[model samples]
Target chain A: MSEDFYIVVIAVLLPLTAGMLVAQRNPYHALVIRGIVGAVAALVYALFGAADVALTEALVGTMLSITLYAIAVRSSMSLRLGLLAAAPCDPDEPTPEEPPLAQPLLKALRRALSRHYLRLEIVPYASPEALQFALEKKEIHATCIAVTEALTPATAQSAASAPYHLSVRLPRLLEIVQNGVPPTLASVSLYRSRQMTTANLSDSPDARHNIWENQP
Target chain B: MNGILIAMTLALLIPIYEAWQDEDIWQTMLAFASIATKTSIMILVVSVLRDDWMIGLVGVLILSVGNASLMLLAHVLRRMNEL
Candidate 1:
């Protein structure tokens, strides 16, 4: 009984680390715990006299799989945000002023995205048209522009309250930005291009930039 | 020999517990590093007890190579934070 006691205890660690892996909420955290699990599992295998199995578990299971999955998770779990490049204030200087409130909004976005284990990637477009075009083309997951850019005579009063406007293409992203971002900083909305509008270019000029206000 | 393995197992629990509760990613990473090293060492001890050359060789390989995964993961994680 004493001879086999250590084996039983070591084998129990396999399931314990696995439970920790499953309990982990963050993908990156889960990946690290998975490395722990693999190590423990290899030890268990080796203890049972399965040296080949242990070797395979340590090399292919822990190292190769974790690296590949890290790449996959890093690439897939990120939010790509397109913004208008700050226009040069002076022709000679050519130094563009960062958009007003861009810093605060970005900070809030980073905080929000971090909670979800998502990275925020900023892509700058030369103009509002380009920003909107990228959204329509699915080039970016979302676009943030000054509210003034999208304002028409009718919405000029109501939209003026918010300096910046964020238009997200995906519904889930819209929800995340809406819930995570504060109302004072930017107004979040869903912008789904009308299927017919894309098919027919003769649609009204503002047809492309339709910003459906999803005010909570 | 059994007493030493038991003691090592007890020591292993410390890092596992640290990993379970710590909020910081780096702290959890530290726990992983500790756990990886400890497990490899435990394997080495087990190999010696059994007098199994194959298991001993496997333990040496793991001791050397297991940490490579940790370093690769750390680089990737550090890059994630910088961006």
Candidate 2:
């Protein structure tokens, strides 16, 4: 009877830790709590004289799953942003200076992504055309392009002041970057790829270009 | 025997609470290390109480191996921070 009492008490930890695991919002923290849950479960199993079960729980359940989940979470939770590669310059070579907002924009992006527990990875393309193509192909989630010349009178004022325009393919990501970055540093807009637009718009190259030019 | 086990269980609660409440990943890692070792030791105690050699063997194996996994997890976490 007394032995059963202790066993029951130890067994209660399983649900307690499981509850804690369910309550965790952070993936990494949840993984650690999972390890705790595994340890408690092993104790309960061994307390019941299930030696094999306890060993398996310790070996495979705790160690293997935690490591796997950590890697999976690390790899999946990231935002990939495409950038225009800087033109070649040498020590003696005089090239146009990088945009003044470059460093602060990246800092703001990192800060915003970190809030969502996401990492920002910048992929540089050789030309603006290539960057646009990558965004259309969904090779990247978002692209940050410097406005070399104002394309239309509508955006000229904002483009002149902002200097950078961020075109994001995903609507949700557009919202995140919009809220995260200051408007003075960059203007944010959503880019709908051919697949997402109507079939008639997708049929004509000119219509597609018009859609790209029309983004707010 | 029951009293000793109960005491250890109470002690184990300390790190579990720490793991739950702490937000810093490293502090939670420390709590995990503490819980892993304490639970293995508790397993060893239970094995001794029941005079079960099989369970004792499992306990010893977990005591040695659990820390190895912890080290692996810590290394992975450290590299994550570096990147």
Candidate 3:
């Protein structure tokens, strides 16, 4: 009876443990815990005579946890501080000369957009709702937003449905806006495409062999 | 703030319900719920302790990465177990 109960508990607990590890606040830490849990779970499965499940869980869980942790850390640390700077000279109170900090950030944003051939527009506003309203009204296509303002349901929902895309460039106000599509989705799609292309390019030779090897 | 809280709550509850029905799905859901809860907690904590903007931005990115990882892990695990 004790052995049967242990089997049931192991079967139930392994996944729950994995889930808890993944949900940890620090993903880097989470991955470490996940690896430890995976190893322990594998041992339990082996003891229960579920060697197949044990082997797969051990290998896949460790690989995935580490990969995910690396990716998360890379993205978080890679955020550019220049992007989060303040918006240029207020349209309402145009100073005769542009601030030194504003010119380069603005130019950098312009160049980034030009690479995608997106038209850039800037609007002066004190409130995010006003900007979102402008976006809904089709006054702008995309803009950089502060993360605090961006997370609002109104802002997030408006962004999801807005004609213009919204993005947050850390440490600056040089939010880039284009004409129709939101930049967020466009950027994500672009990154995914690049990843796929790179994967295909690297795997072509191996793929050919597998195809040939599998052919009867 | 209120709105975000509500959204996070609803997002978490879906997986908790799914977990109740299927042991396999429950495991997966448990993982998801754990991550979502942690993210929400982090966002709330950061909002209180530091700049709301910085933490919020980081929170969203973390949430996305966490969800993506969970989904990928579940799929891979499922396939491997099949063999």
Candidate 4:
């Protein structure tokens, strides 16, 4: 069975080549490639008439390891925070030193979060509504809006007195907000984000006939 | 059998080449899995030719559990990086 030998050799090399390609690109995706290697080994086992071994490899190597890897990847943290900016209603006020805003508080937060094992990425959303939409879509972990009765968009006139509304879904972040943001000047407001529903006909492109009928 | 064994032996070079070329831990794990799979299959073949299913069962065990433990180790290392 020289032809069988050739087939076995080909089976071994194919997955090895493919695994090398995928692993070289991203280690994250390599978890999937590892399963492929396992399946190939199972195929080889089956070819040699080791049926029990083949079944075990297929079940344990190809399936279980991949599932564990997927879960592990999901558990890792990559925080995306939203900062919504609103334009000041006044423009004629004389320029003084820039409003401190929440920069100092956020700096302290960065250090504190590092100690707690988290990465803080500040993403600026154009408007409060956009930020709100992103929060609802779960595109962002949390959103903060400035209630600065400001002189300019860059800095509030009285940053010390500037009140901010914070909305968050993550428990660790909620804990950070409770302890981190200056409570005297900052008012943290917690609100549940609205999840999108497939039952809404008005949300669909073809069905704009009625909006009130679908309210639930 | 000698020719078949040589083919499997040559398969070992792929991972050595891969490990030399890539520094990423996941890549290294993937290479190890690939190499383990190859070696396990070789063991299976040997056991089958010798008419001894016992050694083949051991090969099966490695084929099934080796990648999983390696993957678990990789995941732990990743979580450690986060912590």
Number of the top TM-score candidate: 1
Clashing pairs in 1: none
Q: Could you report the DockQ of all the candidates, in the order they appear?
A: 0.80, 0.72, 0.03, 0.07
DockQ, candidate no. 3: 0.03
Cα shift from native, residue B32, model 1 (Å) = 0.9
Q: Give the Cα lDDT of each candidate.
A: 0.81, 0.80, 0.43, 0.59
Model 2 residue B77 lDDT score: 84
Query: Candidate 3, after superposition: displacement of residue A22 in Å?
Result: 5.4
Better of 2 and 4 by TM-score: 2
Rank by DockQ (best first): 1, 2, 4, 3
Docking class of 3: incorrect
Give the Cα error of residue A120 in candidate 1, in Å.
1.0
For each model, chain A TM-score?
Answer: 0.82, 0.78, 0.33, 0.42
Those runs of model 1 whose alpha carbons end farther than 4 Å from true positions after fitting are: A88-101, A151-158, A195-216
What DockQ does candidate 4 score?
A: 0.07
Candidate 3, residue A209: Cα displacement in angstroms equals 41
- The local lDDT score (0 to 100) that residue A28 gets in candidate 4 is 48
| lDDT per residue as tens, model 4, A1-216 | 764565556465556656565655444446545655665566566556666777677677666766676566545544666764333312344332223347765666566565554556666544444555667767778766666532234333333454665667777678876676666545554556555454542444433311222233
For the record, the alpha-carbon RMSD of candidate 3 to the native fold, in angstroms, is 22.5
lDDT for each residue of candidate 1 in A1-216, tens digit (9 for 90 to 100): 987887788888888989989999999989999999999998899888899999999999999999899989998999988877565234444333445546889999888888888999876665566566668788789988777776234334555677888878999888888888898888887886844334343544443442221111
